[model samples]
Target: MGDTSDFDRFYTDLKETEKKDSVLTSKQQIDRLLRPGSTYLNLNPFEVLQIPPDSDVDFAKKKYKKLSLLIHPDKNADDRERADRAFDVVKKAIKMIEDPDELARCRETYTEARARLAIIMSEKRRKQKKDGLGDKIPEDEPAAYNKALWVVVTKVFADREKKRKMLEERANEEKRRAAEELVAAAEKRRKEEEFAKNYEESRDERRGTWRQFMAKKARKEGEGKSLRGTAFRPPKLKLETSGK
Candidate 1:
């Protein structure tokens, strides 16, 4: 709300006022830092070291040392293994946040969280104003940021899954259409072959009919010539018979 540029100032102020001289026992540290869902919670370095993103190098160093002493494996001999694991996480947190680049990245995520919160709250207030309700939108920070982060995460995953399904559907449709086209082409080729074969058979039948007609015409012409020859020979045969 006011000068929320970085969490370093917040961490400095919180360290001086909140985590100053107070020291927690190893068991207490374990309960607070090594709880069941701590693994996911500790993903954020700021959350891991229990410091703000705007924390300075001095503050990060102090917080790291404090946590180290509290959860030192050697100190917590009864639960050495868990203590070591927790200590490693704290050590990593300090190392990561101390770096300028990593710190900036953390700040970016926090800022993004803030931006999302603003959008959500603005929309909510707009709706309330429309409904004649007072604009009493929630002003929870870092927490609102977390909510915003979740919204982005869920949207990204949903969008990716939707795209994947659409791509799969497109591939399936293309495959189906290709199969249909292949079948149609095969049917077309088969019909063409059938037509060609029938055409050849019909041509041969016509040729045979034409040959038969030509042979019958030739025989009729020969018979007509023989009849003319017989008519010419008839007078010779009658005269010979009368003289006898």
Candidate 2:
């Protein structure tokens, strides 16, 4: 008998532990929904609702009602704090599922995950066959397939979030630049207006200064004309003959 692959061994163990999660109590459900890293984990609506990606909107709505009621703050008075957070998560998930675009995107992510998993399985199986091992792949089973799909979907979501953050940063930078330019333009306009106002307000001063300068020049000219009109009589000359 061929030795079982590690991949197969994992699923074997996982299958043993798989239980019907539908019977979990309200508190257990709350804890599960609010677990560490649940922010990223709950991004998947199907993951949040604990439903299959292929589940229709109607089925999702039913699941939403159940989970929402279970974790609703009013219903879980003793644990209302955590219950509120959990409720919001469930509410957001249902909204996404209800959105036609979001729902389609969720389905596409699953479809892409499945397609990629199929290719990977085919390669693994081919390699196993070449090595003289059986062509069986663990992920061929439903449980293993679901786990693999979850991993793939998580990676896809992470990648999309990174790209979105980058785009948002770029958009924010553009908006900042636009705001700065607007402020700079406004300041420049304000300075120009102030300068014009100051120049206008000083108009009378400048005109008065010009009139004073012209008046002084005219007064000097008049004094020169009066002096020139008088005869240049040398101060009455006292003729003193030099006595030899």
Candidate 3:
């Protein structure tokens, strides 16, 4: 009975190990599938939540709210490792599709990817036609095509987003500088106007004082002459000379 119990315990441990190994294998596969360069499949909240491409504005907002809550770092603290990665991807994807320029870039990337895929497919078809094996085309070609397209799309969108952020920063800097310049110019103009007004007022005050002084002197001369009613003569002074 003791041997049997030991065997059972060993078997249970083996099974547990096998289960752990299976889980690890699955995690590895998921990591590989969602690798950094996967594609431009917009990992945004809306996209991640599988909102339709033509979803209404309100619906998109709702989708974002739902997904953000689910993947928020705070809410998924126990699984923060995965949640953070997913959140970052979602954030980047949202920003990529939000701004007009970024959206245009996304569309351009998609177009370019499609064009490249079409060219490759065309070449393959031509080759098959030439060899009379057109009917033997692989069923997985479409998947391969999509994978390649997305890879390019993702890279282009990422690059464009970086550039867009840089441009936005530059624009903000320019706006700040312009605002500062305008304020400085306004201050300078105000100072100049004030200085001109003060200078003009001072000049007028000085002119009035000079005119008043001249008037007072003239009035005093007239009064003296009127009081005397005649011109006054100067008295002669006696001079005493010493014997040389």
The model with the greatest lDDT is: 2
* Model 3 lDDT per residue over 1-244, tens place: 1585664564354335434432433233224224443343343223343444445546656655655565677876766787677667656656655666755654566676567666666777778889988644542376545445544555555666578789999999999999999999999999999999999989979999999999999999999889899767899899999999
Which candidate, 2 or 3, has the higher TM-score?
2
* Candidate 1 per-residue C-alpha lDDT over 171-193 given as tens digits, one digit per residue, 9 for 90 to 100: 99999999999999999999999
TM-score of each: 0.50, 0.77, 0.45
RMSD of 3: 13.8
Q: Tally clashes: model 1.
A: 3
Regions more than 4 Å wrong, model 1? 1-23, 140-244
Ranking by TM-score: 2, 1, 3
lDDT of 2 by residue, 60-171 (tens): 9999998888788998999999999999999999999999999998888777777877888899999999999999888889767777776678767666667889999999
lDDT for model 2 comes to: 0.83
